[model samples]
Target: MDAVEIKGPAAAFGPRHEDINEDANRFGDRYSIRFVGKDKVCTNLKYKDKHSSVSKDVSKEWCDGCPERDGCAYFEPFNQIKNKTRSLTAPHNYLEIFPDILDQWGDIEVVLIDETPWYNIFEKTARIGAHDISHTRSALRKLDDEDKADSDVIKRALSLLDTLSAGLSDKDGGERQADRAYELATSIDFDELTTELTKIHDGRVLEGTDYTDAIVAIADNLTEIKQTARWASDQGIIGEFDSPPEQLWGVDNSTKDNAKFELRWRNVDLMEIARQKPVFVLATEMPTESVEAMFDLPVVTVEDTVTPEAEIIQLNSRMAGITRLRKRNQTFDNLVEFTRSLFGSRLLVR
Candidate 1:
């Protein structure tokens, strides 16, 4: 509220849904700021009240035909981009999911980020199981026999899946090395695999089968696999830690019939975000060297101390200094007694 009242327009981002709801309730009506939520952006529930339900494709067509599609927040940040005084709030994860969202929002004089965006920037490990590979390959084989025009591409995709599945599940060949994983990853062209997967996705969606969601999920999994492989291979963070052999690709063979392959990256750079805009991080006691290690750029650090307005009281105990193993029962007794003495008979809750 203060940002919009004092400055022209400013956007704030939080990390959780409760944060968004609270901010929307507090400042949404006063400053005319909008909170972008899934319900507001998604067209799935637009016609849920009707007797006959609309398909995802039909709902999208209806949304596109609407007169307010251009300025609607459901489609894009149209009004926010055009109106300089229009400010909006959203979760921090939107930036990670949609890389071009910040650019679409146009220029803002100020961007107030609530918490640390570093945790959101770290990519998670992508896993592909034997079952997924086998199922997708079987589906592609059937697709290959049916679609004669695209049979060659479909066969190539199946071959890549077969190669990956065999390489990961070679029981007699010992554990697959990180270098071999990189070889498997780079052996097939990512763009070619993507094109084939897209064809499968479109066909499955049009067919409206039970496996449409599964097909989309596998496509996303493959894309992530390609991404993780490329990032892990190119970063060359292998051998940078104590255990270098299993850093890139680690296989979990706990389930006898199914083998799960994981692609991991130990260290990654933040240059992509660092170069976008000047960031002011609020890490209370982080070292300058630690900050510089993640972002390979010149950093300026400022140190300050915050003094609490309220007086604080400290209670010392000699028993606290003793290890828990030395006096297990005594430590519990002492804690109970301390709690009893601190707020004597006032129905205290800790």
Candidate 2:
């Protein structure tokens, strides 16, 4: 005997192109009851497809004796099948199934299914999709509220972003390097600096000192050196550290001289110099090795009772020490002269 493969009734089949419009409209109305004011409705009801005829024929037979025929315009079998599928797939919609009760609540949550035949019933019932802009707007509003509630967190986030923006604005190597150095100097923890500096110097461990204090102390001295360099540069005494002439002092002499000069100066030269000068030389109590490493130059500790002239002499001795290190090394003549002028006769010791 041949095996008979009996297919179920055609009514059990999925919705065809002909049933799309009426189905979409019915779904839109149902969806609007729960989401109308809070969300929008959309459907792929293009004229390129014909779904009306098939929907009407199916609606006549399925809804023939149904009491709820007036309220529903969907094909009866399709509607029944879709309703059952939507109920299973979207419990949230099912939870608020009774439209009268949901309407009274004023704020109902509706979740629409995918674009498949099963989900189409839900769409016909509650027209929503994953890409709805209304849903996106609602989610963003919730996030904005949370961020607004935390002012300190927001400020920190903004500060970090500002720092990043400033860094990205400059593409020049010198500017980027200088910015990085500045960031490192300002943001480094003093305690960490102390620990690292201590390890480098093999010095007696200092007590009661933290990273900030150490970093601040070193940063103060660097600020002075930087200021001195700027003052010398402004006086046409020092050239850029990495440029030709390798001068410790002298104004920039590029083709666009004044323009280059202005670009190099502006507010930074004065502000940084002023801010950094006072702390140029750390206190006398600092370990000699650590001080030397911090400045990348020799350091001399003098008693508080030392005179200004004696301090100058001490600086001269330090410069002499640096000169010894530069013996036989190529010296940019202009830079050497500039440095000598800025630091006075002491810078020429060698």
> Top TM-score: which candidate number?
1
Candidate 2's residue-wise lDDT over 219-275, tens digit each? 334444455445445444446533212121112234331211111211122112112
* TM-score of predicted structure 2: 0.16
lDDT by candidate, in order shown: 0.47, 0.29
Q: After superposition, how far is residue 175 of candidate 2 from its true place, in Å?
A: 4.3
Q: Give the CA lDDT, 0 to 100, for residue 29 in model 1.
A: 43
| TM-score to true structure, per model | 0.52, 0.16
Question: Candidate 2 at 195: error in angstroms?
Answer: 5.2
